[model samples]
Target chain A: MIRLEGLTRRFNGRTAVDGLTFRVREGEIFGLLGPNGAGKTTTVRMLCCLIRPSEGRAFVGGYEVGREAMKIREIVGLLPESPGLYGELSAYRNLDFYARLYGVPKQRREENIERFLKMMDLWDRRNDPVGSFSKGMQQKIAIARSMVHDPKVLFLDEPTAALAPDSAKVVRDFILELKHEKRTIFICTHNLYEAERICDRVAIINTKLITLGSPSQLQREFGSGKTEVQIKNLGSRILHAVKKVKGVLKVEVSGNKLLIQSKDPETVNPRVVEAIVKNGGKILYVTRGAHGLEEAYLKLVGKNEV
Target chain B: MRFDRVWEIAKKDMASVRRHRYVLYGLVVMPLIFAIVVPMITILPFLSAEVAGDNLPPFAPPGFSVKQATILAMVSLLSLIFMFIPAFVPSVIASYTFVGEKINKQLEPLLATPTTDSELLLGKALGAFLPAVGVTFASFTGMVILVDLLTLPIFGYPVLPDLLSLVILFVYCPLIAILSVSVSVFISSKVNDVRAATQLSGVSVLPVLGFYFLFLGGLLKLDWVELALFAALLVLIDAGLFYLSKMTFQREEILTKWK
Candidate 1:
């Protein structure tokens, strides 16, 4: 439900978001992954119409970014990177304030506040001022505030950052429940494992969006033909002989060990095993060491590190 | 457009002010000093006249001999506008309403709402300016009452607010408040520090001080025509500054350059 085309935001002489383009489909959890200062938050700000883009346009729920910003605001809920909350007000008061802002009806305001507070499991502390809340509790209130109006699109910036694992799990489950309700979510985060688990498709954005696909698709696209073959016992001479096998590129040896690096594991793995068997070397475990999303992210950002 | 939301924001801000009892005390301290302390000091010489045996100089200004009571009332009223009122408005209203919220990061969600920029501006102005005008008006009334009671026996007349004084209270004070707050809001949006915004916005009072000095030195008088002209000038200044404020309110700059 969100589309960004060549969206760029520059401050002074520096580019914060540089020509970024991507689309988030309906009912999908789209992860915008980046390191710090990698334009993730800038991109989200453009999509939410919190700021005007310098070079391109973004659409949220069919509303143009700058032209229909008010319309976009009505239907898209945003949880900013910082928990932008009035600490002086109680949790209930904070939610009530936003519900009224979004034009939630008088009759439904209290009900909506109560429902989200309960959903966040913060009902007991609803009356206490948010200034007294823990960071996790405050974030929970922030989430409740964002959900009070139940907008069609939710732009969450680092929703689970700094939370205890239990609290993060609570937020994660709540996000998944939102997807079940068919709400589109755009999550900008550095937590790759969480993104890999929750996002339908992931986009690795270093200086720009280097790649966008499902986790496995990216793994296959960037992964080399490196394989791991463990043997119980093999000498240096035999390891060196296995390195000469077809498709085998490199080799290393520890005490009674052999590590083979190759470009074609299908040809090299069986060949190494046969050579080891013929040389009376015992085989233990054979596996391919395909690159994971974490490896992919490191590689992508690493190449662009200035 | 939803008054309820605006009401909620305003009420919430008031509640926050209440929680900071020091700030609440700060709001009233200047008024107390101008309205009560200064008037009492003016009456102290009269009350101790019998004990001191006519040792002190005349309490009224040298050339103006209207009455001691009249002098006391006018001094307190002028002091209220010149010093106490200006200091009170910036600290209690401008800082807390605009800069404080920006520093605390509370403005983000408020801006993220479907509320128009004008609505947000109006709501913040109402939240700060109404209370400022209310407190200043209450102090003016209290000062007049206290001066009347204190001087009724001495000067054979009750202290009264002259037409110029009323105009200052109703017209000039509100204009100054709007100017202070609008400048504070603009500065708050441009800066990340609340104290800087507050300090920067407080500079608007320097021109008021210039006028106070000129008036006190007998170089400028609060005659009907001069007062009306001054009122017109202040209103125009307020409007122009407000327009500049709205023009320079770059939302994109707030999102990016404020860092």
Candidate 2:
């Protein structure tokens, strides 16, 4: 688990992370979503004990950041923003080097290296120089290096950034598996969909805590409560009749999809669907608009999104 | 304090450095040129039979002949070249070790490791120091073999492994090496480029050159007493420099202040 009490980091007169307060529960996958220059990396670095907080305090695994940094570092692993693997070293050596630094015993170090490599689907390439690997492979090896020590907590900065869609899904599934293992994971990312899909609770931040809740909680609290209906043969008659439904507030047509803003879509979506069915439009599917979290995030972070 | 961590770091760095072509070149070529090649060519003409009984310099001690003094000058020059080895090799490696790692973004993960700042510094210093000391000793052995071969027919004996050369090789070489590693650590903090770090750390050899110049210019004799004094000065400087490097090597400083 990780806790920050008014954690602040300032460079010269400018604050990089200011008064950030949050707690990531054990076994929880916490996503830190922010735009560029939004202090996400800075926050992770401070929590990792790689950089000191300029003000206030932080603790990881019950050890204080400044006072017990070595202990805190011992319990936590970090996949930094860049996959800073030594190019000339083999993947096994890279993992072994970090495992030794983390004081993993020889037998366990070797075992963990092989295990993590296999888990990342890189076991066959373990003997090869990391430089010879592609970007996604290198990223996988870097993640394996962090996990080789089996730290109780992991702070991953953009874990899936370099991966293709399939590889990203693999990493996401691996993260979900880590949650099952009860390891606290802190992730910083700009990929809102990935955050929504994976993170148990997400925090949208910009130099300070902007919002914190589960993905659904955020969607409910900040979403426009709109429904997106995929209807076959959506003509003007059906659109007019759907609008004429009592709870329908507004309707916008794009292709065969109708983005319907209803009065509390949870209680109103069924009536709206029935209204469309009666108007001779066959409903293909009806779901909450996909951009709820995104809209909330844009509204929270404002136009300074980088 | 945790020596295993220190050794592991040093080993990893050495592994990384050996793959670099330029680093390997500097470690090998410069020492070979100074130790084997220059001694074979330059000292040959002087040690030849025709050059005997030449005029001695003003610095030559009482009852010393011109040829003996020339041999002594050859010894000093060879010793100077050997001293430069330890000083020069570390700058090349340390530049790549520190500044190179910073550029590669390797230092952040390294700093995030549980090892303390002193442990990290000692580890990197050892990485640069071991190869330098190895290269210096290896070159000295080569020069000794060549110099003894060249001068054997003239003096009826080998002339190397003398007290001054021994003192410099045993005492001053390691000291100069530590100083060089310390300078690189200090300069690596300020510079972002490996070349810049190497160029800036070239200053570590200034003390070696200063001693050589004073001895050559007849202002100093590198007898045991003077060698002791000079070595004492190096020890003090090495300590101060290690302290300065340690001050600059904090984890927070490395992660935040390093550019």
Task: List, residue by residue over A1-306, the lDDT tens digit for candidate 1.
Answer: 888898988888788888888888999999998889888887877787788988988889999999999999999888887787888788988898889889989778888888889999999999999999999999989888888898999889999996999999999999999999999998998898788788999888865778899865665566555566677876766676687788887776656556566655656678888887887777787655544567767877888774
DockQ category of candidate 2: high
The number of clashing residue pairs in model 1 is 0
DockQ in order:
0.55, 0.82
The parts of candidate 2 lying over 4 Å away from their true place are A233-247, A270-281, A303-306, B52-54, B61-64
Model 1 C-alpha lDDT per residue in residues B1-259, reported as the tens digit of each score? 7776667667767766767665678677867876788777766555435433233233334443345534553554454453337434644566676767767777777778888766666666667777777778878888778877876676677645766667778777888887777777677766666567667777678657766666655566566787788778878888987786665555565656555
Top of the candidates by DockQ: 2
Q: What is the C-alpha lDDT of each candidate?
A: 0.75, 0.88
True contacts kept of each: 0.71, 0.84
Per-residue lDDT tens digits of candidate 2, residues B1-259?
9999999999999999999999998888987897778897667767654444545554555554577667667777777768888888999999998998889898888888899999999999999999999998988988898888888876788888988889989999999999999999999999999998999999998998898888778888777789999999999999999999999988888887877
Candidate 2 chain A: minimum summed lDDT over ten consecutive residues — where? A297-306
The TM-score of candidate 2's chain A against the true chain A comes to: 0.91
The superposed Cα distance between candidate 1 and the true structure at residue A99, in angstroms, equals 1.4
